[model samples]
Target chain A: MKKVRIGAGSGYAGDRIEPAIELLEKGNIDYLVFEALAERTIARENLDKLKDSSKGFNPLLEERMMRSLPIAKKKGIPIITNMGAANPESAGELICKIGEKLGLNNLKIAVIIGDDVMETINGYNTNLLETDEPLHTIEDKIESANAYLGADIIAKALTLGPDVVITGRVGDPSLFLAPMMHALNWSYDDYDKIGQGSVIGHLMECAGQITGGYFADPGYKDVPNLERLGFPICEVYEDGKAFITKVEASGGTVTTATCKEQMLYEIHDPSEYITPDCVVDFTNVTFKEVAKDKVEVIGGRAKPRTSTYKVSIGYRNGFIGEGQMSYGGPGAVSRAKLAGDIVKKRLSLRNVRTNHLQVDYIGIASLHQEASDWLENEPYEVRLRVAGITPQYDDAVKIGQEVETLLTNGPYGGAGDFKSVREIIAVLSILLPRDMVKTDIVIKELN
Target chain B: MKLREIAHCRAGDKGNTSNISVIPYDENHYEYLKQNLTIETVKAAFKDIVQGDIVRYDLPNIHAFNFVLYDALGGGVTTTLSMDIHGKSLSSIMCNINLPDIRD
Candidate 1:
């Protein structure tokens, strides 16, 4: 098999598509993968906006992805992304429309469904619920429930000849691994090879995370032109092992340290790094700096996946209000801390117990000094962020108004105001046993 | 009288700011857990186990409360696999507690 070139895009959430397009254009990579939503990225109002626009949550991803589909069609590179939150079929239809507009009506669009079990959980069994606690029957009341799908659906879609494959809530690594499986025709049971491909996808999923973007290496601090950092790319071999490197002349460097830093991100346990394809063993893995711009990742082991699929659930909850203020200058840290105390005391007196409160003096010399805290001598910003849940809307408003008042009478040498505090909806994530649910893929050839 | 609390119980070493997590065994008690397990309560609960000042965070989405227990475990999470070392399974234990009903 020829070297499978995979390109990953940059940015956390609501990022532009130009960087991803640039990488695909320059590298001529076979697959282009992008991630749009994560647990931390979901916003209530944003979700409502998507519903209003006939799109679901995180529609920006689909909008940007639609803009890139034309280019992807012209270049003959298949595009896969996780922009399908709450409504995968609708998002897929939008992509098809974009394809039609671009005169690429022959676009085969695949809608990966069955992951949206928010409304129909009863159709699936819950024998996977191992705990004794009576699981809430949320099938009827669930606002959103998306299954974290694996690469199998994506590979199946690709086989049906889709120009673009949009998924609801597939695992981040699965987005990259699906392309490899399609290209190599690897079976889901192929543990070793599948594990190898999974490791490669995991490394590149977080965009620039593997390329000094979040590295703690002092030498990497002076990396020039970070505003245009290049996203990471993987060169996979038939054996499943791959080397991670960025565009050769890209701004950031891909060193062993950078790769190691990225590896540690979100990995709670090295031995039990679970994924849809396999349980990757990061323990015996070895990283070798083969070249200045490349690092070889080897010795990743895979085990059987647990018979459960992690489900992200969001529900309607009580209202929550949050406010922030900034304190600058020499005594910024002390004043900010003091301000936070005042708010707490006032809230306590009013019997308003907040669900959460935070006071951070961002510019203290002791904090982030090693990361070149250049703002220490010039000016500093201390922010206080607070939130709470209340059934009464009046209570929520009162909390918001009180926190904003801390700026003038509570703390000196600082400027603060009450910002809008939105309602806090219940968003819960549960891992449903895989045996309980089924996935079906429907591919449509749009012409 | 400032009551020191177990604002949050995390399985990580002491540091300025670190990721603190708790898993509720039951979903129905999630709202109750959120109400009782305030940052102050979390701090007051684990004051003895932690060595530093407590700065609590609200993680509404995860249905868990987080706290930045500063200078607590030495160098924070980097010190050790705090999860393994703590060994208390506070998440399950907290779930067992009978929380007072706070619903309207």
Candidate 2:
């Protein structure tokens, strides 16, 4: 049986890197995929690059690569990641530099660029994908724009047979799909196989999410050893059938329940889960518990994808101000509510202008507004959280500053009053015709 | 039993839209969820937050349903004043609806 075992390393930009070390050292995986970038993260990284040229890629790119690369190289496992984020070239260079330092001078690194359309952003703005609004309305405010490039470009980079591939703004699933496509020699037109590979990628893209990290509940869906949770690995057969399991002796279990939840995660339509690579269909997908901690995934099919690509545009929206204070023991909800009122009144008294503001007593209806009765009951401990957005940076600062004043004033047991204000980069989406952008692939050797 | 008792869920957001999938923990409960967890029920349950239309899609094989609520994320993850701007907690909240213990 020709099978490839690909392990998912990191889920988000700042996700735990230790688990990846565990995967590289013990997972016995052929390739490792790390999904690190979110829509706004790139814009933030781009801002960092503007401030300092060497700082644009994922801030932890070097540290993560520094930890995992040697082990990956030793195991002969290739690494694929979107940690390149806003700067794949720089990320690739940094990885090469790390390789050189590790005495792995024969390493080959591939950097996939051309996802960034900051200069060609004018290609968008004709219309928004989901709305009738013109994207050009905020044209000048646009700071960064990157298209979600497909898997084929990543497959192109794989053709060079690099030791590691770093990419910017590629689709999350595409990061994993590209490897399967390359290793299996599957064509883009292999809709069913591509969808199967993509489903595997989607499950692996979130890393621990499928491995019981976010799937725990006390007495209901209890996951063991969650504190030291392990990452996931998908063993994909040549026909695109796969099974998800974690590293041996590591924590977390992969059953039909975990696989089902992850399969549905972030998918809008099961019959036609759209991606640049394929229109995945998970409606008929079955998860059979073949063995303990292993489930065979079957019935993933696909149709052709659309000709257009989704471009995530990041722009300076406004600023955010937030502050939190805590109160404990009996009557904590009322005490926290009082503290929240005091800050709201204080902010108004200070005439802090803001587009919107909210004060919530954590642990009581903070998530489900108006629908929760927990707001009426008394909680053992209540943390007062006050946050707001304002067009002015100073005003954003004021919203949180007012809350921090509770340390001396307002509530008696007020503690942990923290304040912060920062610029917010808002993201929006627009569609671009497939022919408008050319996704370029470049391979670089360790220097 | 409440819907939460019958199902477990995970919520995901993109732009101003949110997709919350409700999967019945027991396959036997799928029929009840399909019957009661209607678009109207979801709309009314989340009427306070869901500012846009509600569209539901079925995943019969998986014994689940994906409810997409548009204009619900308060302006998406990048820009939202809500403490949970990602609406990550909305899934547990989605399970708060009523589910009949016995259905034919």
Candidate 3:
């Protein structure tokens, strides 16, 4: 059976880098992927790029490339990643520099561009998926509008024989699927094969997620060797059959439970799980523990893709101002409550204009809020957190300022005061005609 | 018995929406959970936080129920003031639901 052993390098931007290096060193993988971009990451990166010409890619791009490039080059394995964020061209150039620094020459790095549709998306006058409002509603606030590119273009880049493929705002699964499409000679119209490959991509995209990174619940759902949770490796066959596993020496377990959790993560309707390439029917997908650390994944189907590509639109929503103060010893909850009251009243007295505000006791009600009435007794310690959304940065800063005042303003034993104000680059979605978003690859090599 | 006794769940988010998957620890408990863990039940448990509609999708082959709650994350991770922005902790809250004990 023609099979591809693909290693998941990093799940998110700040994910641990050691696991990827570990995979390259010992996993004997044919391909490696680092799925690093999140919804708002590229939007923020766009702002960064506007500030500096050379900025905008993933901050960890240099470090990740410096670490993974040499190993990937030496092992004759191609790498794919969306660490490019808002700048694939720059990212590809940086990778070439890193390769040259490591004395590796002729590293063909393919950079897939054209995901940015901000200039042209306005013409569509599309209704935002979340609010059903026209794009013009938040026109001034729009920072980025990148279409989710599919595996087709990425597979084309692979044919150009790039040592590494870097892309911006591509569908997460497409990074994994492209390798399969290129190696297995799968056609774009082969929805079944593409669907199956997408399933593998989705499972591997989150790296350690399927290998027990997020599955631990102590006694209830105990996972072994969690401290050093191993990233996942998918052994995919030509026929679309695949098995999820990890290296023998690595920590974490790959079982049906872990796979099941990751398979449904962020998925609303299993049957209509939409990706740029196809609509996967995850309802039929099944996981069976065929071995200790191997779980076979089977039965993924798909329908033809829609004519539209999903575009993640990022806009400047507002500024979030937050402040936190800790109170300890007996009656801590009461003290925290009093501290919250003071902040709330102080904000009101100051006439701080806020779109929304929340006062929470960290140890008690921050997570579940009113939903968590199950706390039968008062906690010995609690951290009071005051946060609010405001249009102006100055207004947002007041929230934190008020919380910091609780230390000297009353509430005895209050310590560990913290405050921060951050601009919210909120993301919404819209569907764009697939053809309207052009995609082309730029190849970079050492001099 | 509590739902946590027989089932484990994982929560994930997309925008302001959140999806919680409930999978039974024991294969036998799947049927019991499917019957009792209704949309109404899940909605009741999450009434305070979730502000939109809830839909339950049953995957018989996998023996899991995927409950997707709309407008659940206080306007999603980016804008929401929720501490657990991704609604990752909602899975634990989901597991805390009360369930009728099933005798062997």
Candidate 2 collision pairs: none
Q: For residues A1-447, could you state the per-residue lDDT of candidate 1 as single tens digits?
A: 556888887435566566787777786688888777665343353356455756564557556766677778888888887776666667777777676766776888777878766555545555222222233654444466667889888888888777778777788888988888878767888878777777778788878767756432233134544666778888887777788887767767786555654554445455567887789766556677899878998877788877878775555555666566777767776777787677777777887755444333444422222222234354556655544556556666766677688756777765646556555444455677776567877676677
Candidate 2 segments exceeding 4 Å error: A123-125, A329-332, A409-413
The model with the greater DockQ, 2 or 3, is: 3
Per-residue lDDT of candidate 3, residues A1-447 (tens digit): 789899999999999998999899989799999999998899999899889867789999999988888889988999999988998898888888888789997899999999989888876676899999998898988888899999999999999988999999998999999999888888889888988889889998899999989888888878888777889899899999999999887999898989989999999989998999999888778999999999999988899999999999999988999999999888888889888888999999999999999998888888999998655877788899999999999999999999988778958999999999999999999999877988898999885
Range of the 10 consecutive residues with the lowest summed lDDT in candidate 2 chain A: A369-378
As for lDDT, the candidate ahead, 1 or 3, is: 3
If ranked by TM-score, best first, what sequence of candidates would result? 3, 2, 1
Q: Looking at candidate 2, what is the lDDT of residue A160?
A: 87
- In lDDT terms, which candidate is top? 3
Model 1 score (lDDT): 0.62
User: After superposition, which runs of candidate 1 have C-alpha atoms over 4 Å from their true positions?
Assistant: A40-53, A122-133, A137-141, A216-221, A327-342, A348-353, A356-386, A389-391, A406-418, B1-104
Q: What is the lDDT of residue A192 in candidate 2?
A: 86
The residue pairs found clashing in candidate 3 are none
Worst 10 residues of 1 chain A by lDDT: A365-374
CA lDDT, candidate 1, residue A183? 83
